[model samples]
Target: MSPDGMFLVTFSIKNTSKVVGREVAQVYISDLQSLLPRPVKELKGFVKVVLQGGETKSVKIDLNHEALSFYNDGQMSWVAEKGKFEILLAASSEDIRLKNKTESSSTITWTRL
Candidate 1:
């Protein structure tokens, strides 16, 4: 991922059953440490994919500046502090499948990644 928070999240899914199935791949961002109160994980982007039995497909989610930010009461705008962040891939909020880390070299402000 880039410091601008422009990242392409790609993952592959396979349907092993005999019937078609649909899955929503959700992307969430987590602030490991924050000065303000925030959710453990925030929904950023998602993709809905349907696959036939035994079929496999790839899903992609585009993450940008907005995805990496949090509402700041001090600045009255969105902000992403410079540090480590976590990216979570899940079927739902309670069902996280994968996790990865990213970092921002500088504090990312509103309208910027």
Candidate 2:
């Protein structure tokens, strides 16, 4: 847990190609306070890793509170609601591989896996 509202995201990727493979990691935050989840932030190409054939690499991404702000249509401003939020890790928007939840009111709890 962090006192300044920041979380460390770490994941691993492997390249099974015969040559160097290029990959991009995307981090997205969604507000889960309503009936349907609302996309708050879409961070694409956040981590670009080039790996040789049959290689693997570990990546770390820093997520701050500012990156979780959502546009409040009723209030006509961007805000980070003090409720449930989900963080998604994906190679692309359509390929989310992992997801975890956090709350804005207190410390965030997450597993390494």
Candidate 3:
């Protein structure tokens, strides 16, 4: 992430099989301490890739503050609190392949945008 709260997540995916296959890489975000009720993980980004036999490719998913924010009912706005967050890469929600940490050092709130 840059100093301005933007992320450029890069990872590689490979097709280990001997035949061509299709796959989708999913990105999920988790807020470690949300004041409001929220799911443990939320799907934020994804990319579909078709690889030839024994092929490998690199994928990137960009995440901004808005992607990590949750809606605050009382405030009637989206809020991204300052704290820890988890960035996950998965083939599906049931199959998380990688886990890592990121943080927001400053709080931000906005409505409809």
Candidate 4:
């Protein structure tokens, strides 16, 4: 993350076998607030990649304050809560491959442009 709070996440995958493999990478973000982790946001697309044996590849995902927005019932709007957030890279929601943390503003209002 930069001083301005923008950040990028890269997913690295390596195929160590003798044949090609196909898979989709999924990403989820959580607030890390309670005992049971709940996803606040899920990246909107499927990251389908094909890799030949012995090849390594990476996929980059960009995030801004807007990407962290959550539905605020009291305000009847979307909000990005400040503090620590966890980014999870997974094959499925139950299958996490990587985890990382970052911070954001106390409260970020979503603006359309």
**Best by the TM-score measure:** 3
Local distance difference test values of all predictions, in order: 0.84, 0.71, 0.89, 0.72
TM per prediction: 0.90, 0.75, 0.94, 0.79
lDDT of 4 by residue, 29-112 (tens): 777552233456566334888999888998887777666666665667667677787888888877888888878756676544
Best by lDDT: 3
Q: Give the TM-score of candidate 3.
A: 0.94
Candidate 3 clashes between residue pairs 3 or more apart in a chain or in different chains: none
Rank candidates, lDDT, best first. 3, 1, 4, 2
lDDT of 2 at 35: 34
- Name the regions of candidate 1 deviating beyond 4 angstroms: 111-113
Write down the RMSD of candidate 1 (Cα, Å).
Answer: 2.1
Q: Tell me which of candidates 3 and 4 scores higher on TM-score.
A: 3
TM-score of 2: 0.75
Which has the better lDDT: candidate 1, or candidate 2? 1
User: Model 2: per-residue lDDT, tens digit, 1-113?
Assistant: 25567777788989998899998888887777743356554662378889999999999987776666655556566565567777788888888988887777743323221
Error of 3 at 24 (Å): 0.7
Span of 10 residues, lowest total lDDT, candidate 3: 1-10
| Runs off by more than 4 Å, candidate 4 | 3-5, 34-46, 111-113
Candidate 2: residue 106 lDDT (0-100)? 46
